[model samples]
Target: MVVLVPVTSVNWREVTRVRAAEHQRRWVADVTYYLCLSAYDGLWRSCAVQDEDSATVGHVMWAVDPEDDSHWIGGLVIDAAHQGKGFGRATVLALMTLWEHEEPSLSGTPYAQAALSVAPDNRGALGLYRSLGFVETGELSDDEVVLRRGRPAQAPLRGSG
Candidate 1:
């Protein structure tokens, strides 16, 4: 069984250790943990996936923008040992559900739209996102491709007279 745990209560060192072991590329592991910490500080939301044994196998960070009310999935990382076990997709879906349930005003805005950027070479991640209803949005940087999920347009205004 996979479980999502709040980053606030998690040990970053442990997470970094696991990631370093799993990711063969030292830079990837380092960057993943760095982004994880940055997201926690900026968004106040980060999560890690724990297996049945309670070991963290993956992590993700997300937040809702205060100004435009847009939701952003900043980063996702699955330990190499836990990769290809469906944890990545499961964790993302779980986070989306949580976002959907949050109050729109306090959370900024709850629209059917969630955005994320992934390396163009990450076919596995692209496939997973596509399977989960995320589509390419034609927005790209030199190294990353931007994707979006949920309803195509902004949701109807809520609580408006």
Candidate 2:
């Protein structure tokens, strides 16, 4: 079984191992470490996707928008060795479930929405997001495309089990 666990209580060394193995540079691994630390500071939140054996296979990061306090998924990374194995899809789904159950502030910000940007050339990720009900919002950067999925769009698919 796959499990999504809060980054707050996870072991970073394990996460670093997976990241270092997948990414080309130690910089990527270092950035992941700092990102989790920043998230734990309560300025943001992140999680790790682990297998039944407790091995971390992926990670997702998000932060509450300061202007609106709406949660925005900042990054997602599944270990290269684990790609094409459905873990990426499962991880995003789990994150969405967690987001939906979370309460919004009294400001009536709706349930907020989760968004992510992927490289335009990343057909696998684009297809996975679309299959999971995320719609293309626009371009996020010079080479990245943005996708968004709100709570309403998320409801009908809850039975995807």
Candidate 3:
């Protein structure tokens, strides 16, 4: 069992240390980079993916594209040592489930759509995202493939019924 815990609640030093070596290509450079991004919008919520033991085995974040108003998954990193243990898949599934039903908001307004970018050669990530209903858009970011999933359907407004 994995859970996404608020970043502030975890030992961030350890979370950022969940990194692969310089020779090993990884999605995120370090968690500290993301923590620095906190200088900006509330659109981004940094979270640690904790295992049943409550150990921080991975990291994930959801940020709204301020320009397009679409929500995107960013900085998903599972420690290489913990890779292949299903942490990535499980955490990702939980993340999608969270955003899909939660009616994501940015600056107090509804934020929708789903997007993520994966490097073309990153088969592991492609496979995982594909399994979770993400598809390539043929759009590239610094050579990374952009994928999108529709936001989960929102429940009806209470009084609008």
Scored by TM-score, the top model is: 3
| Count of clashing pairs, candidate 3 | 0
Q: Which residue pairs come into collision in candidate 1?
A: none
Candidate lDDT (C-alpha), each: 0.69, 0.66, 0.76
Tens-digit per-residue lDDT, 40-113, candidate 1:
56764666677788888877777776755667775577777777778878788777776766647536566657
Residue 83 miss distance in model 3 (angstroms): 1.1
Clashing pairs in 2: none
Higher-TM-score candidate among 1 and 2?
Answer: 1
Of 2 and 3, the candidate ranking higher by TM-score:
3
Lowest-sum lDDT 10-residue window in model 2: 20-29
What TM value does model 1 have?
Answer: 0.74
Model 1 stretches with alpha carbons more than 4 Å out: 20-32, 35-41, 103-106, 151-161
Query: For candidate 3, what is the TM-score?
Result: 0.80
Ranking by TM-score: 3, 1, 2
lDDT of 2 by residue, 43-83 (tens): 65656779778888877676666774555665567777877
Per-model root-mean-square deviation over C-alphas: 4.7, 5.3, 3.5
> Global lDDT for candidate 1?
0.69
Question: Model 2 lDDT vs. the true structure?
Answer: 0.66
Alpha-carbon runs more than 4 Å astray in model 2 = 20-42, 105-110, 139-143, 153-161
Cα lDDT for residue 134, candidate 1 = 88
Model 3, range 1-161, lDDT digits (tens) per residue?
A: 79988687436776777775354455556767776665365567877888999988987887777788667788888887888789988987777667655654423436456789998888878988998889898898787999998765678998996
